[model samples]
Target: MMLTRRTITRGPFFWLSVSSGIVIMAFILLPLIQLFVAPSVEMLRVSIQDKDVAHSIWLSIYTAALAALISFFFGTPLAYLLARHDFKGKRIVEGIIDLPIAIPHPVVGIAILGVAGKNHVFGQLLAELGIRVMGSVTGIVTVLTFVALPFYLDAAKAGFEAVSPRLEKVSRSLGASMFSTFFRITFPLAWRSMLVGLIMSSARAIGEFGAVVIVAYHPMIAPVLIYERFEAYGLKYSQPVAVWLVLISLILFFLLRILTLRKTVEQ
Candidate 1:
């Protein structure tokens, strides 16, 4: 009798849970659907043909890819160290790495400007060397990197942690050097997570506007361009560009998802 009563109550709870999930999914997807449908097909086509829009899209992709590459090269070592070591102040170090995530993105842009603006020390030095950061592609990449670092770093750290130390130890015991063991064993096992991190970092960088706009507004990325169009013209002009950006993002995201899933199944 108790079991029968419990089963009857469980049905209601299960339906309630499913209803809540459906509501949340609709809430999240509705905006995206509107973005796609609100713009006419003709407007989307014309927006994509605009030279400035095309250039901004290309610039966003290029700079974001460069930022992700830089993060992958430098952050991976740190992630490995954080995962494997028990050093003093490790928590503090990790906190510092994650601090950017907690800070307002515009503040990050301002902070970066203070350190890397034309009159600042590093900025002055770089200017002397003829490398402009403020109002240049370099600045865009710099701001993107600053804001996107934590995502990739945390993902990589988690990936490395997921790898079994025992496998690395075995590789080392077989006369493999540490570097060889990591590349041959640890990295391979952990690469899928790292790739996911890279995709997320690149996506975040591409979508970043607050920081990038503050740093370099001339060679505009897509987000900055969308804002400029909205403020200068109106939603009629901006919506089309926004729709393009969303379509591009969604396409890339799904491609990466498919690739990641395939790799996971193979492994």
Candidate 2:
């Protein structure tokens, strides 16, 4: 004669929540499923064999990897500093770090162009040194690093924050140097999250289009190539490339999920 909490949770509100969740999930997933399914096996085969597609995919992969590496080397120290210290203007610094993510992609491209275009100071300096930013792999990697750096930085900061300061203090008390303490104790504890962040940043770099297209239109990465094909030819020409990119993204995402799950299990 009495309804318990569990029984109450199964009422109309519960069903509504379930239905809404399903609809949201379907909204996100259906387009991806359609993209993967739309391309025929032969079409996928041909797209894979196409040199331009292959090259673009490779370019995306390697440039993204390079971007992730850059983020790791530079962003890690900043992340550790942010996590361990309280300083004046720290909030402003954090905002600056995150500003790229809030900016529109096309605007980011324009901003980078303004700073790094051949006529710009840094651009001119690089040019004098026989290096180019516009329309080169270096430019692509530069923009990729700009847009993707925040992901790794934020993740690494969170990871470092989660690690206890006491551990480092204990190591210091035991006669370890600051650098040795971090490398031996702190870094290993935080490495998994850093790895996840690197993967996410790499994925973001691989998919980046607007900024990268402005920086390096030639030697296209996969996303720019997809946009180019769609603009020049049509859906039919672009769909195969889209499908290929989607497949690779799915694979990368799947691996990310597996790593995350394993990390969870280990923790």
Best of the candidates, TM-score: 2
Question: Using Cα atoms with residue i matched to residue i, what is each candidate's TM-score against the true structure?
Answer: 0.91, 0.95
Worst 10 contiguous positions by lDDT, candidate 2: 1-10
Overall lDDT per candidate, in order of appearance: 0.88, 0.90
Q: Mind giving the per-residue lDDT tens digits that candidate 2 earns over 1-267? A: 233567465879887887898899999999888887888999999998999999999888999999999999999999999999999999999999999899988778788888876778887887889987778898889899999999999999999998999999999999999999999999999998899899899888888998888778898899999999999999888999988887787777888899889988987
Query: Any residue pairs clashing in model 2, and if so which?
Result: none
Off by over 4 Å in 2: 1-8
Clash count list over all predictions: 0, 0
